[model samples]
Target: MGALDYLSNFCTVTTTRTKHKAMQTVEIKVRMDCDGCERRVRNAVTSLKGVKSVEVNRKQSRVVVSGYVDPNKVLKRVRSTGKVRAKFWPYVEQHLVYYPYAPGAYDRRAPSGYVRNVVQAFPDHSSNAPPQENFLSFFSDDNVHACSIM
Candidate 1:
């Protein structure tokens, strides 16, 4: 009986260590529009066992969970909060969707189906190539000091 008890204890410890080593972090994209949406998603994920932390970014529609948790389980829990279109965060990044194998999407010559965006790190050498410009920067006014002096 004592030998059996010792064996069981050793098995339990080994399994626990394996589970801890398998710990992972998963990022999910959830379309949370308001405080209620964010709260629902957060609450659902926080209840999962081995979950160390939960972060929700409504503007980016992102939820990041960290701890000894199963990624699939975390995703399912977030979806159960009335979010049906939940997906892994990487799918939402345009670069990964188009040029996944390329490093940093730095090439000026984009492959087929590439989503064009400003801030191209490597501009094409062709003379006709358009200059790189951040689309968002056009609308931003960075001359705050100039305006303040006026």
Candidate 2:
């Protein structure tokens, strides 16, 4: 047999013998408020069987768990934390939603409204101004003082 034929035979044999496991990473929407809540949820999830890792983002109210795990089991474990509420977000097959926060999922109405106000007020200013600066400027005015100490 020639080298080409030998290589093809080897490839075919390897392909026949090898099997791939279907490991899935599931992203869950969690309602978390603080760092303590996040820690509680993370610990609860990481303790579950087949859970490789757990990541909790408090600001986003989301958790990402990866491994060969049952999505239902994972959700149950997360909910057991009692610090947050967890749910699976349905994903589209063609789009392949990998992360928890789908489009506009993390977008908040308050921040968007604030952005709209800023844009309306400063229509002439560059739209590219950093959001942190804009938020800070909103708080800097005397009329917006947060504390009035007696």
Candidate 3:
């Protein structure tokens, strides 16, 4: 076989395009003080090629972008709009936080109903079960070793 025939047999020739990112929602915190700020951020994010939608919540200083978009690009776009303080949303709902008033979880500046989500800020959840459960566990039938106290 000639060189062309040898290569064709070994490798199929096909055009390839860059892989697209998965559809996802990226939430960002942008301190939008006025309608102008909100509009600016929304405009910047919507300009991106793959952005399907942009929702700006000025009250909560939150921006939710949904579609096949790169999160870094979205954040960069928001910052480029002169919202220098823009960043990925760092807070979770107060209920998700183990300690609502944790030293780091509690943010006076954060909007109501949310708290900073930091691993170190919350106590371990494994210990949160009631004390009664611990005593009952000792007597559980599954326990091969019975408690000495009956």
Candidate 4:
């Protein structure tokens, strides 16, 4: 046997290692009105396995979940609360119907330019506005008033 052939036999082989990706944050558009509703939804989601943290913004009517849990599974747990319903925000196409645009309702919509004005009036709402932009636009005065919760 050649010297090169003998060396090849003793060569050590190494495999490349792949790192697992960190879990993504899941944002859910939930219909929660009161403190009780928020608490119920928060408790339900935080109790699930793989859930690292949960933030429920009652004013924005949204829940942001960060953890290793599947988003769908987290949604199911939030919905199971029975006090309110939770859905992946992106999947809610009919925001007007799902959220309704009035004034007081948890799922209600704000008026036209409401977002911009909110930002002008309260800069904090600006940070919270982006997530609800699509939902708010659906409530423009030109749209059907039937969907208005007011």
Against the true structure, whose lDDT is highest? Answer: 3
Per-candidate Cα lDDT values, in order, are 0.71, 0.62, 0.86, 0.66
TM-score of each: 0.51, 0.46, 0.76, 0.46
lDDT by residue for model 1 (73-116), tens: 99888888889899876433354443444455433433343433
State the weakest 10-residue window (summed lDDT) of model 2.
110-119
Candidate 1: worst-modelled 10 consecutive residues by lDDT: 110-119
Off by over 4 Å in 3: 3-13, 121-150
Q: Which residue pairs clash in candidate 3? A: none
**Over 4 Å off in model 1, which ranges?**
1-21, 91-150
Compose the digit string of candidate 2's lDDT tens values, residues 61-150.
668898878888888888888733467742232222233243333334222212112222322345675544444544535666563332
Ranking, lDDT, top scorer first: 3, 1, 4, 2
Better-scoring candidate (lDDT), 1 or 4: 1
- RMSD (CA, Å), each prediction: 13.5, 14.6, 5.7, 15.1
- Best candidate, TM-score-wise? 3
State the local distance difference test value for candidate 1: 0.71
Residue range 59-140, candidate 4, lDDT tens digits:
7677999987788788888878884455676323233233323233332352222221121232344364555446655575
Total clashing pairs in model 2: 0
The window of 10 residues in a row where model 4 has the poorest summed lDDT is 111-120
